[model samples]
Target chain A: MPRILRIAGAQMGPNQRADSRPAILARMIALLDQAAEAGAKLVVFPELPFTTFFPRWLIEDQAELDSYFERAMPNPDVQPLFDRAREKGIGFYTGYAELTPEGKRFNSAITVGPDGAILGKYRKVHLPGSVEPRAGDRFQQLEKRYFEYGDLGFPAFRGPAAWHAPVLGMLVCNDRRWPEAWRCYGLQAMELMLIGYNSAAYDPNGGSTENEAIRTFHSTLAAQANAYMNATWAVSVAKAGNEDGSGLIGGSVIVDPNGVIAAEAKTLGDEVIVADADLDLCRQGQTKMFNFAAHRRPEQYRRIVDQVGAQPPGA
Target chain B: MPRILRIAGAQMGPNQRADSRPAILARMIALLDQAAEAGAKLVVFPELPFTTFFPRWLIEDQAELDSYFERAMPNPDVQPLFDRAREKGIGFYTGYAELTPEGKRFNSAITVGPDGAILGKYRKVHLPGSVEPRAGDRFQQLEKRYFEYGDLGFPAFRGPAAWHAPVLGMLVCNDRRWPEAWRCYGLQAMELMLIGYNSAAYDPNGGSTENEAIRTFHSTLAAQANAYMNATWAVSVAKAGNEDGSGLIGGSVIVDPNGVIAAEAKTLGDEVIVADADLDLCRQGQTKMFNFAAHRRPEQYRRIVDQVGAQPPGA
Candidate 1:
């Protein structure tokens, strides 16, 4: 029963577009009271982390793009970081910009738990940029002209028996470089994933083929190879610096299911880090090198869902 | 007009179950004349690169496991390393142990082409170990008691118009740590991949939780995050050290398409490692952050082809 947990991450640092909403919920309730004073019990935080990465703008006012979404999640501008993470019993995970009551828009995320409920939610299935607006780009990703794609899919849940309930999952922020949204939460054996990002430390298409240290080494090598090919225990985080002139890219990590990097983020801002994790080190890659029912084949996967694009052989 | 190519990887090192077959095709025609004197127009080579990783022992002799398969693939003892890689016009990729004239058995690989033909053939569909035989362990992965799984699926080919024909694909050695076999050859827009492995530098189920420098950093972090989430240009290679007594792992990379490490292998023995690549740097990740039709969703990847294992939430 070596479940362990502890977690943390936080990272953040840029909420500029005239930051407010009580200053980004007081820097996310001070990074959830410095990750519940370092004993952690979850935490995460990043992908929209409440604004200033508002899809790098092209808003064209619809009340300034519905004032960067969230028509309800904990409503009162995020009920004081969910009433200070349910008064510090902790458990978090973030990302936002939702909307919906028949209005639709996505790029979501969730996770909550230590009694504040919401365990797992996702939505943000690999959206990267454009839906118009790139002509002369001075920062503009527009998340496909303002959200929609993620119709809630890569699910996976549980995580409550005080973190021992580990399965958990959640992506957002370019769905951490899509390995089919971490093999659909690693076919549900998911033992803690929770990502979040802001990315674009350059190369948001106004290209020079990526910069900002190779897009922070492609965002920590896509969270250390999709958390070592789904043996789980990831973290991701990041919101990073220079938002009022777009930049982002912090390299916040955590990783390990042997993807290594146990705690990273040598600062791009609010910081926090931490680690502990263990979840039985994802049982030696889910019982010896990812025993997806003894190495999955899914009938050699139907071109991963009968093709979505890229056909180039004779094309 | 900047397609560039020049690849290479060779790698090799241990063949010893009393080596010979013209001394392993004269060490694969001396690593294909040292990757055609380093001008290398593609080379790769590893998975069962002709003998000695005989599924690490447990063989009960059927003519000694049909003397390690390959009944026809330039047979006649690998025809002088495919006539010296078609007399150095170069172009390669390897792996072996096939058999098929209906008697079945796979774990293959191919590729050939600098005019010598072949151009593509893959088999090893993520076949790893065991088909029974664990109990007293003294090394025995038995590749599921002698191959089969790869009924030819992750195809993707082309590569000829003097290398600019790119596309290509192929994976062996635990199907390069399966991202659904690199998203089924990155949905076929492939642009170069070609792997080959031998893995295990310890922990081939004797478990001490991996070693040989974290199994050569999980075999170059699964070829640099599946060649940066399939914006292609890979390589992989490696057969590496100590055979008859186990141990394997040796870096052997090449990567690119933003996964970076363009050429590695600081030896585990016979090396080669070159690079060049630049197939238009896979068009900045297939037109902006892996544009699998402006970012894949495939009905939220139906739990990666409707589940094969790990259904853990309350199960």
Candidate 2:
């Protein structure tokens, strides 16, 4: 019999600006209670689960931006929910904006064990948008102004509660768009990948509605390719629904090691998508046809990291 | 002195159902005339330049599908465009749906030399969507139903006009999504990559609008990465406009060997984007820090082609 690990992708509704931390925590606790009742060993939340997508609008003031980031994981406001999850013996993944003491901000995620202890923390690597204003008319996505590139490279850790079933990696929204994130974790032999995202509607300068399907399919295809390539079960959860008139389309999903969509959420609302993943299946996948480890030709790829526009020694 | 190729990306507007092949061919000829006037040695047209995106609707009849595909290039209608280009001594890249003599269909592109002879032919390798019906409320993307998986791998050929330039490669719409296409061509020392696409608005079922910016950015980033990594010039052209109520966004662009946007089309309409690509600059990029040829690891990847699932050994 395969050792089945039941994981729940908790797709939350939009986090309105008016919503308080206590209210969001109450909702998260309710979700944990529900997942615990459903017999889920782990529950994953979307990126920045506690707040609205702050990168969409441009904000200049430092103190104004600081208010959006959490200084500590379970500061006084979020301890009860973490305490409750520990009592229920369920490991969970959560995403938020983090503000370090050195005056730097990072989009980060944390994995909490059933015992209420933190298993590991991961900061997002690929920072989207730019600090300077763009020349075009599209909505300015000012992520570079808000968050710094993560210091942490892609590292998979062995969690205490996840020992029986090794679950190793995590990513935030924009990080999923790049294959390197999954490739890095795959190189580490990560068995399970938990990724969360918070997306907004309205084309930032509003081009055409065309390529929407391709855009979404890009993610699903990435998940499929990454899962099959890495031989790891990938669970991607999203925070859907309109926040401050910016609608977020929810296509939260759970893919098996073979890249099959086992379960997926339907709408931009609060919902739970569960999938029973067999860790052995990933081992089987890695050993079989979809193996990237066997077919990659690094001998021919020596120029991948070479910097362009570098000056010559004498020049 | 650098051997600079003046390449032009001919961004096209909508191709309506009522637009006859002759009418479309006339427009293409006009674009070619304009490109020739501008002294552009090479011109690239969008994917499926003759017709509107037929993949949007799920069709089953063979005759209807055949109608969407081109039976013969330069067959009566498009011959004028080719004749004009040949007369003008201009090499061009154009994409179309191909219906073979055996009745198999494929998304393909062809590069024609100044003498009107075919320089290279490429079929899209990455086929998106389901082979059969999808079983839910999800919007059906029927690419697998319409075209067969590509047989021809990434093959680069020498251009007619540029005697000193290196080999050039071609890729179609969906093929642009995968890095394997670029890597395959890169391994062959392709100094230039030409890609054509006709992408629809965000899929109403699979993706939301929140990912628009990243999706657009991915297009440029992919080109930039490929150009930088392979020491090549990459040009991507798009067919933009609302056709049959479906919108296609256009941001056709040109990226140099250094991964900078040398030129870009103004988002919407029939426009021409031009850039000067120097073979010597690409050679310089290849020799620099991002040189993939000098730094690859083949010993570690030994499992990429091992067959998974239930395939019988050598059966």
lDDT of 1 by residue, B113-158 (tens): 8778898899987777789878887788879888879887988889
Score residue B73 of candidate 1 by CA lDDT: 90
With a 3 Å backbone cut-off (N, CA, C), the pairs that clash in candidate 1 are: A20-A23
Residue B241 of model 1 has an lDDT of 90
Flag regions of model 2 displaced more than 4 Å.
A134-139, A161-163, A209-214, A290-293, A308-315, B1-315
Residue A126: error of model 2 in Å?
Answer: 1.0
Question: Judged by lDDT, which candidate is best?
Answer: 1
List RMSD in Å for every model shown.
Answer: 17.5, 13.3
Return the lDDT, model 1, position B259: 84
| DockQ for candidate 1 | 0.33
DockQ values of all predictions: 0.33, 0.04
Q: TM-scores across all candidates? A: 0.39, 0.55
**Looking at candidate 1, what is the lDDT of residue A292?**
92
Q: What is the DockQ (computed on Cα atoms) for candidate 2?
A: 0.04
